[model samples]
Target: MARRDFPRRSDPERSPAPREREPGQTSFLGRWLRRLLVWGTALTLLAAMALAVAVFVTERSLPSYERMKSTQTGQTIVVRASDGSEIVTLGPSYGRWVPYERIPQTLKDAILSVEDRRFEDHWGVDPVGIARSVWVRIQYGQWRQGASTITQQLARNIFLNNSRTFDRKIREALLALAIERKFTKDQVLELYLNKVYFGGGAYGVDSAARKFFGHSGEQLSLAEASIIAGLVKAPSHYSPTADPDAAVKRAKTVLGTMVRANKLTPAESAAVDLKGVKFASEQGQNSARYFTDWVLPQLDLVLPDNDQPIEVWTTLEPAAQHAATDAIQANVPKGAQGALVSLDRDGAVLAMIGGTDYVTSNYNRAVNAVRQPGSAWKLFVYLAALEAGYTPDAKVKDEPVTIDGWSPRNSGGTYAGEIDVRSAFAYSKNTVAAQLGNEVGFGAVANMARRFGITTPINTMPAMVLGSSNVRVIDMVRAFAAVSAKGSAITPYGIRKITSTEGEVLYSHRPDPVQQLVPNYVAAGITDLLQSAVSIGTGRAAQIGRPVAGKTGTTSSNKDGWFLGFSSGITTGVWMGRDDARPVPGLQGGTAPARAFAAFMKIATAKRPPERFDTEVKLPQWQLEPDDESMQANPDGYFYADPDGNIIEPGAQGRTPSADSVVPSGEQGVPVPEGAPAAAGDDFLNRATGRQNEPPRPKPKPSQSPKPN
Candidate 1:
């Protein structure tokens, strides 16, 4: 109240005044702290809301519990033999589902011990386990542990696709949480056991148990359960069927895990012996591997653009397949390869052996390998000649011949002089065939081959008459099947019918109306000639105590051997060769190939009765005339008739001269007598007279020839 009453204590030793804070410094700190607190609370709330929204969206996106529970598994594609016997199961095969109550306790314990020991205690996502896994990964510089629990696996398998990405992982986690919320722990376990993939196309635990042990999941032993539990990590690698030792080692690891998890006592774990555990036998599994492999690709053709599982009923006869395989493996020379394909009269593939061992090589020689048919190619040549109005009994000059500088000689390097076309074909006379090719024109021969279903290119060269072009065994079989089917056109097929798992018909092979690919007389004539080949000539080794018709083929340098034959019921082709094209010393088509053919055909046709070929045409009688130059060199000379029914020399009465009375001409290469037929130069005369003496027909339009090997 008194302005001057109090002493001036302010100036008297004022305690050191607190240093004045920088202008607005305290306010700045306060303002910053307040702003930080507000922002933190707002951000925390926003983050919490965002997390809830994400969780809600994820929950909405997940498949419903009922939908997941009712999901149909990916079924197996079953390939069956013609007899309806199981051949092989194609993936992804879901086996019979096992309920939770039906599952073996040992299996569940083993799975829990190894897959997710904390399955019962943890939430859908185990943070502790994840932390441990991350620490372990960081320590090892690689992923050593997976924290995925059974519920998570079930979630991924059921509701999510198999993609290793952050988004997928998040979705998987969310789905796992939802699954746990909706289903009990037992339900999740049951679903996981029923949906997990095992090796050998097995999907569920039941299938795995059966696939490995040939038993039910409920009947699993401790060792069996442990082994099956071990396969969840890498099914193929740890499958007992594929690798028993690795599987045993994995099972032992599983046992140790069980002991550590207190699911099994140490003594009990040690007592589990994998030695007594019998794995499913592989003999049956591999029995049809080769066949299934050949047929697997055909499924797509039968059911194009189909992703659903199906049943393929093939044309394979198990017995026939076994017989063919055995015959090839037994008769084929060591170090050489062989193939056999058998077809029915309607061109259904009965059996096929692509190689000696499919595991060693998967190159399907029967379907893929194109090799020179050698004399087997002569079938087409003879067929062409028959179609050109030449009879099998028509005589062909089997002497040395040259066409465009290509001279073809007989296989034995000896000529039969003048022989019937039947004999020429039976003996595999290259010179006679070349002459026939020249007379009929290689273009006609090529056309004839095309008519018989030979897709390989045919050149106009005379060498093609001796099978200079390569042809597949399947094509050759189809050609022979046409002959066996009495000139019916053939389209070889393997798949007979295809059906979806639900028994819906996808494809069924309805045979086309039979149209003659060749004249009946022509087919009959070829059959007669080929029958002679098997009975008394080059193909005799293929004789199976029944009426059989076939041709033997040996390539140049004996590099390839082949026998294409057919019975009234089945047609088969056999090929033997080295992969490197190296000549097999002393190998002949009439030897190994014929024997193999016989071996398989005998079994293939055992149930069928022997039947003669269709009625053969009666060829008109023809006599060679005196003017025929070929007869001038006839060593058997008593007057021989040429293929044209012309007498080489006339008797005093102009009647046909008797073989006993006609004198042999001592001269060699003598000039033709007056009015004698020119040496294979007159096309009109050759065609009209039905004689194999004309030059090659004018080279037709040049077609694309198959590339030579």
Candidate 2:
């Protein structure tokens, strides 16, 4: 009873009373202790608020408009043809930029409905919209939605690399908030429009408009604008180039979104009027767009934007281009491809054909191709010798001789016994040329080729004297032009001048003529010899009824065929072959490409006067070396000795090689028999029956060796 009275307050089933405890312990707290605990919590909250304010103040401020503007900027490649017509294209991607006033209402409505309904009202980060997006994403069990405003997109594109990381997300949020403070809603929309990609080489609304409807941004129709707007999420999936049907379907979905968001009433949606729009031709407007592709890389080094809007005045001659193109299309044999180029005497490329049809295949045969020049290389060999003071009349034995394990053969099967330089060239005797190249120093021939602008990899082996190494058609044109110009080596050029759109001159190409190569007489000799090539050698098919000088070349097995010749005023080079190196049967430079050359030059040289090389240059006469005389024991119809010590001949084994006599296996170079008659005058240089002199003997393939230090 006493315990109950003493504790009267300590009821087990009700409220307990305070209890005394040891030094640092208490059973229940008094009113003062409770107040202290409450006050401590309030102070802790105040400190946290102060720290947060300090953090907010510490962040460096950045301009919102600058961030937005940076995001929308992109790279664009505007290609213009040599004729100054726009063609082809490429770009750096972001949002498709459009002017605010030019944006279609339909496009604006669709984008707003899908991306940010309150884009105009929010200051970039919309709390309510984010909450709604989170709810939707959670319900869908995946992140299928976002609440990012246009400003957020700008922040991500401009200041961030394309990475999906948490840090980036935080940065995006901060940047978005900053952007809203600087740019107006309309300005932000404009930046967004100009920054996005619509695929198919389109960047920004203006580019997209030009690409899809062949019009500017201001002229875009509602349907065109909607199509572009639909490409925001995935440009490739909705691109007309990649998937037109998918693009249209995506555009329709955008329209549906606009309807659902009440951005467009049902009646308004129905009345908005859209027709399926057809995009511009993916190939572009310039007819010679492939040629433009050839010129762009060079122009990038000399223009504004590194690629666009520069007016490039070029040396392209439409007439020459048409002729070359028509010739290739009409003459390239089945299963065989070909290329051709025409240049003025000054080495300006008037016309270039990359291939038979650039649209079907973009490989540039005119410049990129590097194949054996075969006997055509003889021009350089002979030129070097002539420059070294040897005359075309100089006698060299056409007999087979081995040089450093390489036995160069004549184009025919047999070796001519004795031959003068001119006859050996006309006949394309491999043995004689190889020997001559060796005598003059392989370096001489190589240096001569380099001076002519043959910048490709060179094989300095003695075999290169016989055109054993590879050379490009463009380089060959410059090389041949040296012979046509009588000495000066002119650099080949396509672009003549470049100017900004505002008409300020940026760069101009001056004809860079250099006399680094053959002297005038030596050049004339080479030219005269090459004239024989078209008149009576492997390039007979290229012969025109004018003073034309050029060379013909056929690599072993007909893997390559070429005819590079020119008149006094114009130089043209033609090549025919497969890109994959497949053997071309029943085709040679003399037949197809040579024919094309003839056709093009017929039109090209119609108005030009007949001109001949200056044959009066007092180059020293050449005598037949004894060693060379022994090799000419089997001389073919290709060589003859003159009192002046010069020999002239053609490549055929006899006056006329029987069709059956033509070598069957395409391996060995053509050979000539001994005692073959010398070519009399220029007629002696002309081919007998328009038949290619047999290809020269195959040199021993060089050994693969490690380069020496």
- Each prediction's TM-score versus the true structure: 0.69, 0.63
Candidate lDDT values, in order? 0.79, 0.69
lDDT digits (tens) for residues 321-344 of candidate 1: 889988998999889999998999
lDDT of 2 by residue, 1-709 (tens): 5555443566677876677567865546665687788998899999768644543542245544544454333344444446655545545522234558868776777778767878978877899888987998889987877777787887676667768788887778777765666567888787777766567756677777777677777777666766877888888888877888887788777777888988767776565444557777664323265567677678656564543344566677766777878888888878888888888988787778887676688878788878777777877778767765567677778897888888876655798788777777877888878777776667777877776778887788877886777888888888887777777777777787776534567788876646645555676677667766667766777777777777778888888888888875899988888888888996776878788999999987777788766655554233343222211112343454433333434353255533433333552354433544322332332353243554433433345221211
Candidate number achieving the greatest lDDT relative to the actual structure: 1
Runs in model 2 with CA error above 4 Å? 1-60, 63-79, 84-110, 131-145, 161-170, 253-276, 284-370, 382-447, 455-465, 493-529, 535-537, 543-548, 556-559, 567-570, 576-584, 596-709
lDDT accuracy of residue 31 in candidate 1:
92
Assess candidate 2 and give its lDDT.
0.69
lDDT score for residue 589 of model 2: 69
Root-mean-square deviation (CA) per prediction: 11.8, 15.1
